[model samples]
Target: MKIVVAKTAGFCMGVRRAVDMVLDASNLSQEPIYTYGPLIHNPQVLEMLEEKKIFRIDTIPEKGSGIVLIRAHGVPPEDEKALKDAGFTVINATCPRVVRVQVIIRKYAQKGYSTLIIGDQKHPEVVGLLGYAKGNGHTITSMAQLLALPRFKAAVVVAQTTQDTAFYDEIKVWCKTHAPHYKIFDTICGSTEKRQSEIRRLARENDAVIVVGGKQSGNTKRLAQIASMAGKLVTHIEDASQIDYKTLSSARSVAITAGASTPNWIINDACSKIETNLQKLHPIKAALFLLRDFLLKTNIMAAAGAGFLTYACSVLQQTAQSFHHALIAMLYVLSMQIINNLFTIKSDKYNHPQRALFYKKNRTYLWVLAVISGGAGLYLSFITGMLSFVILLVMSLLGLSYNLKLVPIISKKGQIARIKDIPGSKTILITLAWGTVTCLLPAVANHSDLMPVAVIFLFAAGLVFARTAFFDILAIQGDRITGKETLPILLGEKKSFDIIKYALIFNIGIIFLTVFTDLLVKRAFFLAFIPFIMLLLISFFEKDNLISGAHKEFIIESSFLATGLIAAVI
Candidate 1:
């Protein structure tokens, strides 16, 4: 079965902003952090926040302390003032779109205008908006409620940010005819319009549609309502576990979408589950998917890529007998990556669920594998030379201690025990380590000249740095939840991507320069495409709608294998 995910399926701008602000407050401060209400409509997010000790309070306390954030659904003017008066530092994390609607209401309410809102009467956003209406507000959910009201001498009409587009259009047309003097503003969020329209089109095209989001989410439910209006099979589920495969077994194609408040992890989990179940009918696609996911989860694909990269770098330096060094790189990478994964299960619970479960189930065997591969790497380096042996030994020990508590010091916030506790250490260390194993070790084995060795090391490190930073971007959501200060998290996603792009472009330029100057073999010119292709892939992610899951991860790891193929062919 063919599966398609809608581009606008996760975290519209406002919810993302609110969530980020709250999370940042939680991670960077030692004070108690609270939201005035649940951060968003998504239950999973609220649960995760709770786990992180970011609590929510419904009422303003008589004497509050620490910090409190306004939810994405903006609060009343009075509520905002009260929270501040209660001695709590308030951060308004309200969606700017919702704030726009509030501004429109407040502007007209001062002129004795009645505010007519086309949305659910009890919705939090509508309630917040009404707070700005100065007591002359009326919520009209249907044509009857809208027509029953007296045509006011002066009134302003607005729809809830998540109001149904078709319904709101009807409201506008009716109000324009009946109350010609009334001002009508397009208050429905642009995101809501796109999502509704897209779901309608997707529902019409696909055999079945699965809407993944909180059932109580207004926009999410409206999406289901729209899809169901198309007369197709539609399931509105909170997560993957709620899906009923027996109900959807006959469908040949499925369309997946999520609400604006929904996070990528939940949507991805749903997509993964559905794809896994549906792919069983196609043996070839199913087999390939299983194989790819296995390699990704086990870190085997990463290890193989390391081996291939080592071989390519060796050939670039004109080193003799590159296979053994490639093996050493592979073993070192396999052992290090496995150990890293084992220690990162907390973040993996939100980043890569399947891999977390796999690690837990095979903990003992994986430990055995890591120890053996690391030992084998040491043995190979020892056989090569004393310098190689010492370097590999030091690198391996550092890798092993990365997740271990060496400082044994506890602070007011928590223990800054492990090397991983140091912010932005992972990306830099991984790049340096990969470069050492792939290029520097081989140069040492053959006593290659410094200029070529240094240039080749830069080439290898540049690609590995891009790879690490790119994955960090993909896993930013989980990393934030787990309080990880990755390069992407510290620099922000856009800046990190900018850095990755510049790095890749630089690598490409270096490759061409070396090839043109005859400093490296002509086959090394093919290596330029590695970074080039990666740049294009990163561009796809920058589109801001692609799902970061197994498929993207598999393709990225395969880029390393491309290096091996290029080396072997020449």
Candidate 2:
């Protein structure tokens, strides 16, 4: 059987050193052997030790001068004292990289600098490092955590051996700005960095990447995350035996990488299984993958398009009271779909092939729906009056221009396809269009005053700009990858976050203005403001994950509903 192995495999320098120390002590000592933990994360290696009569004890077992092997993770200073006091022969197998972190913390602490460790606080390595420090130290998991710490006169920062380098740098910058004096020691292990860099290179070169390691291993999880960041589909596995044949069947090129502790033998076994299994894939499975990909993209586009349309309709209904006005408002929504489809053709072909396939298969059906919906809306506007029809026509043209010509200009310059790509472009065009056709167009057709319509536009403009900024921040990464110049990407993450912070402040200002003008009641709006504030707080903390996008959408939509309910009651 042929086998393929990753370049980086088996025990790393640190793990090898630790394991050798344990084995050497077991052979030389006359006492019964025991370890503080499994020694390393690999189950096979731990089982092999058990077969050789090695055992484990959480604390020094009562009764004899037995040998106790410290795990690669290392233990706190207090635990080391307890073992020494118990009269057991202590065999130290702690990884050198972890020990260096403890030394750095202690050195800084003794010099009167507050120590800060950036990683998961619950990890044994962090806990051990904390024990070496004399004074109260802080453990920061995210940028938001930095806000809760008191201003320190001087600080020393160190990272977990396997934490992402970029995240560490971000924390370092924050500390420098907030503390009087700050020192950063980059303690991430070289072996872990080499493995992660190799995985990133593999992900960029291949259609998909597979990372094999124990699920509970921190380094293994980091490897998978790094691959995903490079825009590759990554599947993390415990061993080669866990390879999902179905996932690999259609992959044209697959790159495989493994964590430091994974053995070469297991990697070879998995590659063999993948090659053999891929050769026998049925036609039905291929068809299913194609079908699933098409449905997923279409669903995403449809959902986004529908959300834009719904917001347009709601803004219109606030000032318009006639059925004819609502119908004209729907025409602008129809035009937006037609426009988005026209500009997305190339992107859908390259980055999203499945969506391109769907468009090819259903272009005629989609175009026909666009025509019917748009024509019906125009006819409703005509029935109300000639002026209403002209206004609806202009709004339709503006919506079409967003995707038809404007988006193409940005795309040629390699920018993300959004109207806001043009700096200082007011959403006033879209917002006014929505508010006029939906609210004022009908009111005019019914011969009513336009004061209510003017007030509605003012409120819609502020909300529209806020929503645009929120989305830009959320899509910053995708925009950067595609070479689109958006506010967030141009400003960087910290500055972008600051901009959003101010945008929220501006939104509150608008609410105050509305109250003074008596367009909206302060009491009713403030009632809904409670949830909005909660949502903003959640968004601040959840900025680092995909869940943040979902949370933001939920909060925005809920706020809209709550505000509408309050309006109805008033």
Candidate 3:
């Protein structure tokens, strides 16, 4: 079975802003934080906010304290003033598109024109838009209602930011024919229009459509309603648990989409659940899927890649094959990667739903395994030599402290924290660690010359850096939400990709240059081509729309296996 995910399925710009605002407030505010209402219509997001102690207040308190954020659906100006008057700090997170509608209404209202809003009257966005009309606002959901209304001498028409485009267009036709003198503005948000358009295309292409979002969200419900009009089997589910496997199993292809307020994690979960259910229908496919998932979840593929990289680096140093060094590299990376995943599961909730669930379910067992692997790796390092053991031990300690708060807090406002908090540190640290273990540690144990090993270290680090940064680019949304300062987030996606591209090109160039100069073994030059191949694969994955997330990950990880294969052959 084929599963297609809409590119515009998850949170849109406005919803993302609201969520980021609330999360930042929760993280930075010393005082309790409260949103004037539920930040968005998604219940899963509300639960997450509640978990962070960011509550919602439906009513304005007599004496408010701490910070109160305006919802994504803008509230009335008076309510905002009331919150301020009640002694609460207000951070308005209203969608800028909605604000544009408000501004249009206010501007025309000042000229004595009444306001006509095309949307559900009770929606928070419409309610807020109404406040800008200065007592001359009316709402109609359909053309018949607009036809029944008394004709206005002068009026401005607008839409709730998430209003249906076709319905609003029909209203536009009615007004053009029946009330030509009235002013009309297309206030439906661009993001909303794009999402609706994408879903329509998805519905046409797939046998089954799954809409994931909050049931109460107006835009979400409208998506389901519109999808139903396509006559395809459509399922509107709040999360993965509600998926209708019976319906999904019979379909040849399925399309997954989500409302503007939905997060990537929810959409990812829904997709993963459907795929898992479909896999169970065939024993061979199920086994293969399980094996692939197991290898990824346990970081075994990544560890194998590390082992391969170690082999390549050793060849560069003109050293004989050392399975012991490779094994140590594999175990050390597996330990650190698992522990890092354990700490980063929050971001993974959005970035990698299946891995997040795996870590959650087997938390204790995985932690124990990480500790044992780390200890065994260190023991093997000690057997290799005192220098290898000390270096590995120090790196292990640094890895363990990556997420721990290390900086002292001098005051309430002054606190330096975890190494993870440092801007663009994740990619750099990961690259350095991988380079040290795979190249430097082994080189030191073998008593190789410092200069040659340093050159080899740069080559190894460049490969890992490109890989880590590319994943970070794919995971930008989740990392931003979880307040991680990864390289992609700090530098932006396009720049990060450009950096990765150049880094890959540089690695390839250096490797070829060394080979031509006879600075290292001729066989090692073949390993350099590995990054060039990876560059092509990564470039292709970015450009291809049909490639699934799992396929992309597997292909990227498999790129490193070429190193081991070529080293063994040569």
Number of the predicted model whose TM-score against the real structure is largest:
1
lDDT against true structure, model 3: 0.84
Residue 208, model 2, lDDT = 76
Predicted candidate 1 versus true structure: per-residue lDDT over 386-467, tens digit per residue: 9999999888877876788654535445846776777888899899999999999999999998988888899889989998
Residue clash pairs of candidate 2? 319-439, 320-439
> What 10-residue stretch in candidate 2 is worst by lDDT?
542-551
Candidate 2 stretches greater than 4 Å from native:
1-6, 60-64, 279-570
Off by over 4 Å in 1: 407-417, 544-548
> Candidate 2, 318: how far from true, in Å?
99
| lDDT of model number 2 | 0.60
Tell me the spans in candidate 3 whose CA falls farther than 4 Å from its real position.
342-353, 404-418, 421-424, 481-483, 492-495, 522-525, 536-549, 566-570
Ranking by lDDT: 1, 3, 2
Taking all chains together, the TM-score of candidate 2 against the true structure is 0.47
Q: lDDT tens digits, residues 380-451, model 3?
A: 999998999999998887787688764432333467567776778889988989999999988988888887
